[model samples]
Target: MDCKVKLWEVYGDRRCLNTFIDHSKAVRDIYVNTAGTRFLSAAYDRCLKLWDTETEQGKPGFTNRKAPYCVGFNPGEDKQNLFVAGTSGRKIVQ
Candidate 1:
């Protein structure tokens, strides 16, 4: 069965600005880019979704080979991004 996690943007005093639905078996990890332009989520669905934070919508991103336990973006690179996901084994999707 697929489950979803709600994403929320917190603002000072306001608490939340936006909320989104994550359609995955289990949302295990999330990574926001340094520019805050995008959000990457890894889940048991064995997929990673890149989302546009500005629009609060999903963007085309990478996919994993198995259920990802973690997701992160590598630093020190411009124009290029690195996504590391911990699945049944280590998988790197760039």
Candidate 2:
């Protein structure tokens, strides 16, 4: 529960590639887009963030009163930019 998100290399050396230290609380969920250009992270800090895969820079996206539990990216090409976040408040937000 260090409130950090990590990226690891799948090939060769097999070491951590980067660490995202943005959340103030434990990160509960993460979703990566189909093309892997972006990702989303939901945390118990009651915040959701969007990140650039290559740059590792993140910006706040959603800040609900309730903590977010999960996140997912839209798979359809027509809605590729859309994503959803499910919160502990029992609501799913887009």
Candidate 3:
């Protein structure tokens, strides 16, 4: 894997819009917030990253002892800043 995250515009013309290359390993999962303004990614590099959709910029936000397998953001409007992740170690982190 090239270790890149690509964003696409699906409705109009259906084309790639941006590419984010921050994780050192293959991205395992991605979660986009409900408003579509931000996203989170989990990677084999044992880290979770947060990205700003508009700016096309991202960075590692949390590191796990085991590789992160999946990630998601809280759906509650009042808890949008919260998130959770599952790791290879069979543990969940919030």
Candidate 4:
């Protein structure tokens, strides 16, 4: 079987928010947190942006990193909501 998919993001007027990202490396995957408070986007750009769903802006929590192919929050942990990012050569950011 073969499958195809299209992705898009609409914000505010749905027309004013027209920002395109060239993930030439590849946007391998995407994941959103359970609380819906934050979302993590992974790309070949070798970087990850933690977005604030409520304000539609980047969160200041996690910063200073290189391009990441995958990212997610640590499951079954508390006190510190740390993110785990996957990069090339079997590297992980915690």
Clashing pairs in 1: none
Worst 10 residues of 1 by lDDT: 1-10
lDDT of 4 by residue, 2-77 (tens): 1111233566555433232433445555666777566676665565667665666664434334567678876654
lDDT of 1 by residue, 1-94 (tens): 2355455545657455665566547677788888877878777777888787788888664666767777777776574366666776665445
**Model 4 segments more than 4 A misplaced:** 1-26, 60-66, 77-80
- Give the distance in Å from residue 29's predicted Cα in candidate 1 to where it truly belongs: 0.5
In the predicted model 3, the residue pairs found to clash are none
lDDT of 4: 0.57
Candidate 3 to truth, TM: 0.93
User: What is the lDDT for 61 in model 1?
Assistant: 46
The lDDT per prediction is 0.69, 0.89, 0.89, 0.57
lDDT of 3 by residue, 13-90 (tens): 999899988888899999999999999998888889999998888765688899988899999987989999988999
Q: 1-94, model 2: which lDDT tens digit per residue?
A: 7798899999999999999888889899999898887899999989999999798899766799999899998889678789988889999998
Question: Model 4, residue 71: what's the lDDT?
Answer: 81
Among all windows of 10 consecutive residues in model 3, the one with the lowest summed lDDT is 55-64
Give the per-residue Cα lDDT of candidate 4 at 28. Answer: 57
